[model samples]
Target: MSFKSAFTLTSLFAVTLSVAAPARAQTTFVDRPAELRSGTCASPGEVVTSLANLVITAGDPQGQLGATPVEQSGTVVPFAISDFLAADHAVVVQQSALESTVVVACGEIGGALNPDGTLAVGMRGMSESGLSGVAYFTPIDTFQNTLVTILLVGDGGTTTVAVVDTTVAAGDTAMAGDDTTVVAETGAAPR
Candidate 1:
């Protein structure tokens, strides 16, 4: 074959290969917004210990979703915050001192995500522990990851007021006791 013809043939073959070859796959990224949900717990002082474990569960009736350990500082769990927004979802904290069996604090996961994609709820103390606090669920990524934050406060003391004697004459009233004020002296629980 002539060198010119051979060159032309080779050039055509190369162009055909290039055209037939598949294009590189283009990566696609989805915009999954972050989400958050928070709940409050009982006063930290009411908890027997500072150490506890946080669990995310199906809360309407309080079913276990999975066991995830979380310290007072906070911990990341393998879950999407939006999935737990159902009325039946809940976050609970069990006292480590009791082998994590005693529920010292709990909060139901509910409400819509805020404009910034966050949810907040109250955590009430269990077993009359008088504990109270808030939990904040924040999405760490677009995938299944959420940062659970639990903040608990001590029991706020109670106040007692003296009773006024109503048995006195219709025109006069008398104080039967003194006023007493009590402040909670318990220390704040670690979160």
Candidate 2:
């Protein structure tokens, strides 16, 4: 009878410990889908290797702003994930052909993925100190077919927003959310 009681007590203790533990969030991964790297979508004009200046708003209290007509080029690839459960996975890399700027680290863009492969999040950007300034990328449309990238670059405490329309030839786009931005959709504001 003592053995049975001890065993029951042990089992109850184990159950209590397991139930009291906090739930952990799952980690999402990012991979470039082979389909996005090749095929008709990778062609010129169709590919998302460029950006166009749209709107610029100076956030500086001194009212200072500037813009250089940059003839820059880079590639923006769609993210492929092994686990769809991890919604915080952001793995978009922008490779520049110019020596003026290079993107070192790009983590999660602050958004959740939808069942249909549509990722819409607020825009967030980080720079490598004085080498460059923080730049935010916002998605203006859904990624089910194509991706529209809206970029807001911050320099000298000013903000410049550029709009780039990408023809993914059937792809999805996700934007990160910004806590500073009061936008109802992307959660990102021009910085």
Candidate 3:
């Protein structure tokens, strides 16, 4: 091709790339260990973190085109466990879906309040799935909302992960899965 043609092609490619790139800025959540410095609890202190209700449907992946996604049985708890973030220390919470069983894991916290008023934090804790490895949590602020990406290492070198977007308000009870199959089981087994 001639020099002019080559230059035009290069310019066109650059323009295409610029246009194709994501126009809106957004935060991305990742399953990686992050550094978190804890902050003092607001006022008298209370539980500030929890999980939202989620129903996992096994059959429909597309939700019948434009229709809303239907809820099904055997759903997974997106964030069944998390560490408590305090100004002094980070406390790991090993909570299972089963009300009878209890698991405990502890860790340290490093976090601070962002200038935008959102709390920025990270925590690393011992595995609550009877594994020898560690687990990590990183919270990302996207245009929609903040999400916590949890990386969990279970027994036999198995890894389980979930990106938790919804949070249960403090002092409120977290709803259980709609799946009736595992309702009689001894404990909550994450998928």
Best-to-worst ranking by lDDT: 1, 3, 2
12-79: candidate 3 lDDT, tens digit per residue: 99888876653321112211212112332121123233332223332212423323322212212222
Model 2 stretches astray by more than 4 angstroms: 1-95, 98-101, 104-119, 127-144, 157-191
- For all predictions, the C-alpha RMSD in Å is 29.5, 21.7, 17.6
Alpha-carbon error at 113 in model 1, in Å?
Answer: 1.1
Which TM-score value belongs to model 3? 0.28
User: Top model by lDDT, which number?
Assistant: 1
Choose the strongest candidate by TM-score: 1
The true-versus-predicted C-alpha distance at residue 64 of model 3, in Å, is 30
- Model 2 error, position 96 (Å): 2.5
Error of 2 at 27 (Å): 40
TM match of model 1 to true structure: 0.43
Question: 1-191 in candidate 2: lDDT tens per residue?
Answer: 69999999999998888767543221111111101111111121122222222222222113222233111111222322222123323322232334223332233334455666545433233344111222233233453123423332334342222322333222232322111222222221111
Candidate 1 regions off by >4 Å? 1-71, 157-191
Model 2 worst lDDT run, 10 consecutive residues? 32-41
Off by over 4 Å in 3: 1-45, 52-86, 89-91, 99-101, 111-129, 132-145, 155-191
